[model samples]
Target: MAKKKTNEPKTLKPEIAVGVLGSGSFATAIVKMLVENSKTVHWCVRNEFVKGAIELRHHNPTYLTSVSFAPKSIKVTTDINELVSQCEIIVLATPSIYLSDQMEKMTCEYRDKIFVSAIKGIVPKANDVVAHYLRDNFEIGFRNQAVIAGPCHAEEVAMERLSYLTIATVEDEVSEKLCQLFSSSFIKVEPSKDILGNEYSAILKNIYAIGAGIAGGLGYGDNFTAVFVSNAIREMEIFLEAIYEAPRDVNESAYLGDLLVTAYSLFSRNRNLGNLIGKGYTVKSAIQSMNMIAEGYYAADSIYRTSKEKGMKTPIIDTIYGILYEEKNAEKQFKKLTAKLT
Candidate 1:
């Protein structure tokens, strides 16, 4: 069940110190945003070479090398505890699969700090969203938790292209402060109170994007792709409503806009994974080939289990799960899925 929103407001300072945990493309992009508004940003990068490169070269060596940073404005460290102790807010951008392991390494208590999940998938074994995971394990209350959702992509952020980010928290002050930290000339931040809805929408969209890629790889043209995505949004609405009944517009950018971009954008890693699978690569081979994580690959199973337990009807999720996890033929599953979609 979703936690009830509290009437008690949380306090946020004007000058906020931010820390980001993760060294991926999105993490690099987020650090870039922080540097624009912050004097110094604390970042946790476990990789020695990546840490050395960022400190010495003023750029991430592995991801998003094109976007350079002022080395003096950022503090790169190998210790999660050190970073956590130094910063007021910690943005968790690590892959959801690795979230547990990463949290286990934290020597400091996270209960007092604000945690924002930039990760969009459920934690693997726990089957809980990032917010719930923190709440259950670390006693981080919903009041102190927030989520960053996007119809936006890290690649576009790296290019300094215009993008929209939805920052969701039950506390208005927390959302506003995060918006101030992240908003730039090109990056527009919108505040939302629907944290769970937006987080689930963000997770569900990647699964739909994989379905879109499967269709594209199977030679289904724009006409079919359009129908697939339209039905996908409806399915996402049903799933979100079933899980957490909120007065949210599924048509909002955080929900519908996010689904559209992930399903159609060239930068979508989930779509790329499905495309490879559709073109005859086995799931193992497809996963092996990509350097970045295709979140949907992990999210599919988690969504499938949760929706099943909830007794919700999610045809799009079911179909994608069958193709990706059940090893069902992609062509056959999509054909069956077409009949279910309007």
Candidate 2:
């Protein structure tokens, strides 16, 4: 069963320090959002070079260039130890593949702070989501000051378009506090207690986005695309049942909203990667052509490996894996998948 929202109000502030774990577009956009709202943010980059670029240029020239920033007003740090110690809220915005390595360098003192994960991918090595890593490695709890920020795009922040996010946590107090802490003029925040379904829905939708792109790449029209997304929802329903109660909101904004945008938007690396696969390009060529990170490629292996280990049937995930890494042709794989359902 799902938990209900409480009506208690708490202190909302404009000056809380937020620490982000990556120098990527999403991280930069998050920091920009907080700063625009009058909160201070400290972004953690790997080296002095990326750190210098963001600090000096006021823009992430490498990852999110179109969006300019004036974060000279905030702090930027390269040291992970120093970052975790200073912030009230810690945001993990790194890719899923780099999460374990990043976690190894941080201390458990962050257990007292609130954790907000802006990443959305399944880790292949550990077969776990970003929140699971924080909980298992740092000993964080489900109901204790942890939340998942899902289906938010960094590019939209560059346009200053009004965007919405679902901050999922089990603790009522933490959820209520975060909804205010992260809310801003251009960024609206929605709170939910179903942390489990929120993250899973976000991850699984990316996999489906790749599938949708592959369909588009194959010259499939709106009729086929309609069937594709509908079946994908059924796929999501089966997958979400394993871990969480059905969240209608998950299918509404964060889940389906992200699915449509990423599947069709030119800004989506996952869709671009899928288009390359449909065009007979190898995974190496696809990734090399693009300079951004596509969570679906890494997540494909994670879902495949973990689902196999857990004995879960994920046909869409399996078909995507086959096209990218298994040397299966896209047309052949599509027919195979269609045959199974028919």
Candidate 3:
């Protein structure tokens, strides 16, 4: 069932040291948000070059270069162990594929801290969502975890465009406190308790975005694209219900709004991957051409595997999985897909 929200005031934790564990675009955006309400953030970066750039230039050299930081707003490091030890709230913002390797160095002490998952993809090897992966590996409890999700993109946040984020957690106090850290004049925060629903929605939207890109590459008109997206949302609602069995509406920003933006936005890497495939690039060639990780590529296998195990019928996911993993001809598979959509 959808949880009810009351008019009670949000509780803010004072002097909470928040640490971020990524150097990507989204991680930079998150740091930008947190620093507004914080004096210092403990950030761990894998690349020593990125660490140097942020320390010396106060700007991320690779990702969001235009977004600058203040003189002492961030405390950057290469040590994950050190970062987690200093902060009470640990935000995991690394790409899903690299998460296991990046966090292998950290100690188990972080299991007691509040974990916020900013990765939109599942952990590839384990086929588990970030929260679930952490719970199993690090022994972190669900109440200690929260996820930041929505239609908001890292590029938009870097531009200081008005954006909204949904922070999902099991505890109201966890959500309430984390919202204070993420809220800014340009950034608004919404709290949700539907962690699984929100996380799965984020993962699924990337796959559908790839479908959108493929359609564009194949010379499908806007009329066809519009219909494709409409059917995609209904499919998303069904997938969510089958997986989580919740009474929540999938039309909210965390679900439908997120799916819309990722599927059509120019900044979508998942769509970019699909576009390359649709343009006759081999899957390997298309992936190699992209500068960033396309979460959809890694998530397709996991979500598809899970769906089959549960005996649920998800045509869009199945089609995308067939094209991506099975190396089925994109044109031929999409032609079949076109017949399935309403």
Candidate 4:
């Protein structure tokens, strides 16, 4: 018996077509992983030059220059709305400071699509994580949203080195789909149920990494750094438990692993910014010199303001905020900060 073909459309997996937004190292790395699985990655950078360069040169002229793209592997554009319309999953890798300006250009409804935030910082002014921001503004419920946390760095990913990624989502199907999209010979994917915890851990770790860099800049040795990081993880675990009581392991790669890498890695821009600040460059000067966004710089202020509202005691966060925002002396502030840490 021959099976008859009907006028029916074939159903695809929910997030097979993935779109990426941003023009940074992390965003490029994401497209790298997606290319391994997806036929064509729909990517939206900020402007025409970036779009043209990548399409013409088979490489991003801005970041991750060594990683070339296959011809026709990436469908690059400057229009966010167009990218969203064609893809089932959208990965936001833009820095937090620029997210609002980029998102403002959007005119499409996105609640039906799966959104994965690779951003590790909170949206400024809103003083809220991207999950909440998307929920409030875009009407995308938590179920359709996910987060990508790294212990894995994009530089390492570009090298094809072994790396691990933690994908956090409340929905099991999302985790499964995202896992398949990113899994490769060099990458290992782990799914987590504590989405909020992973997101906050990602944010807080960068702040602590800055503090670690400050300590290094001030000539503090590895001994002090070890203690500082230990306390940072404890602080992160406490904050996570206070907000959401779930069966989450703080020692897992998503939380503590991400913290340690950002704190110590040479590639961490947040720590580099703090090092410059601790070495006596003004926050303004440190930021201007870097030419990259150190998310912790913005996150510190937002977290401090939000914590005050929630009645949370985040001494590390407060200390960093004071140095970065209030123009407090870094040396004096950190001296006072040490007494609060065990």
lDDT agreement with native, every candidate: 0.89, 0.75, 0.89, 0.89
Q: Return the lDDT, model 4, position 97.
A: 75
Give the C-alpha miss distance for residue 99 in model 3, angstroms. Answer: 0.6
Tens-digit lDDT track for model 3 on 137-222? 88888889998889888999999898989999999888877988888888989889888899999999999999999888878879
Model 4 segments more than 4 A misplaced: 1-15
How well does candidate 3 score on lDDT at residue 269? Answer: 96
How close to the true structure is residue 218 of candidate 1, measured as C-alpha lDDT? 86
lDDT computed for candidate 3: 0.89
Residues 1-342 of candidate 4: C-alpha lDDT, one tens digit per residue:
978967443234443989999999999999998888777899999899998899889989988899999988899999999999898899999988778788878888776899999999999856788888888877888899999996978899899888899999888888988998998888899998777888888998999999999999988899999999998998888788777789988899999899989999999999999999999999999999997899998888877777777788888888999999999999999999989989
Question: Candidate 1, residues 121-231: lDDT per residue as tens digits?
Answer: 989868888888888888888999999997888889999999999999998878878987998888899889998999999999999999899899888999999999998
Worst 10 residues of 2 by lDDT: 5-14
Model 2, range 41-60, lDDT digits (tens) per residue?
67788789988887788777
Per-candidate TM-scores read 0.95, 0.90, 0.95, 0.94
How well does candidate 3 score on lDDT at residue 240?
83
Largest lDDT belongs to which candidate? 1
Question: Taking the candidates one at a time, how many backbone clashes does each contain?
Answer: 0, 0, 0, 0
User: Which pairs of residues have clashing backbones in candidate 2?
Assistant: none
Q: Positional deviation of 339 in candidate 4, in angstroms?
A: 1.9
Q: What's the lDDT for residue 249 in model 1?
A: 93
